[model samples]
Target: MDAEVGGTSAEEDYKPESWYKVKKGGKAVPMQREERQPEVSGAATQERPNHFKRAAGKKLAEKSVGKQHVRIPDGATRIILRPQGGLAPLTRLGAARLLYYVCKETGIFYGDARRDILSPNEALQTLLIATEDKKRAEKYQQIASITTEEGSKTEIKAHMTIPESRGKGVIHNVHLSVSDAEL
Candidate 1:
């Protein structure tokens, strides 16, 4: 019989080799090949500004020297202090000086002056109050003391105290005070 007529030809029965082959244990393993990921260019890498950069920008803006002015809405009782000439950049000490002037002029005492008023260096304090009256200073101190005492008393009365057991194994009788129950 002729090869073309009686049976399949070599081209018709040919099978291409597979990329993977089955091992003796029946595990089909892939043939190893060299593969790599595409490289990224330096110019394509993007960077974001960090917290330091943002904070530096804010501080720079605040410290920019210029004519400082405050805009007050009509009918507002608050007095706005505006610097007549171009003011120097505000430093920590400068802020404290400004606060001192405001408090003196308005006769308003801001609580927690220790933090609000930067530690008054000798020169700054001298500049703050050129002349000091002993009577007035004493009166102000007395008022502050009275207010602090009253505030502490109220704060103490606001919280209720509960007696807790000293140890998990011991059961103790806790006597609640009249003030604690009222609270």
Candidate 2:
């Protein structure tokens, strides 16, 4: 009988090799041809940006000279009142009454501003300002003493505190190593 494939006699296709005629790699195991690894002709890794050096410019070194961001100062100024004999803690109503007296004297510091006068922590010792006229607010700088409703004289101190350089969005790149050398 003619061994034909796809309606064609096998004799026309003279490829005489058969599966059984092929060479065996032993134990019917599939085998792969030995392949030589490609030659190492150049660097296998890339040189990335280092801390001291970058692709564009030098990093922000402490010695680097340049303009810095402008920071806004605190909005409200604080007033501290130290009585001749440290102020006795006052109740809320009594404190408000005391601030009323203070505002009566320094009407510029406390005005129509809702929070023009506030007793933040030291109800009897601190007077807060929320006035808008900052230029005129300097009048508070001249204030030295306050006479309370009881007519007791007290030394007055005022100051404004600012936040430290928060280092917002600051980044510092540390050296990394793949081997013994820093990269």
Candidate of highest lDDT: 2
Give per-residue CA lDDT, model 1, range 1-183, as digits (tens): 223645764455434444787899999987665558456674443223355677888888876633233332332222112222112222233655555443443354644332222222232221111113333333223221111212321110111112232233533564565353343
Instruction: Quote the RMSD, in angstroms, for model 2.
Output: 25.8
Cα lDDT tens digits, model 2, 131-165, are 33565356554556666666666666655432244
TM-score of each: 0.21, 0.36
lDDT of 1 at 28: 91
Mind sharing the TM-score for model 1? 0.21
Runs of candidate 2 with Cα error greater than 4 angstroms are 1-74, 79-84, 89-93, 109-114, 123-127, 163-183
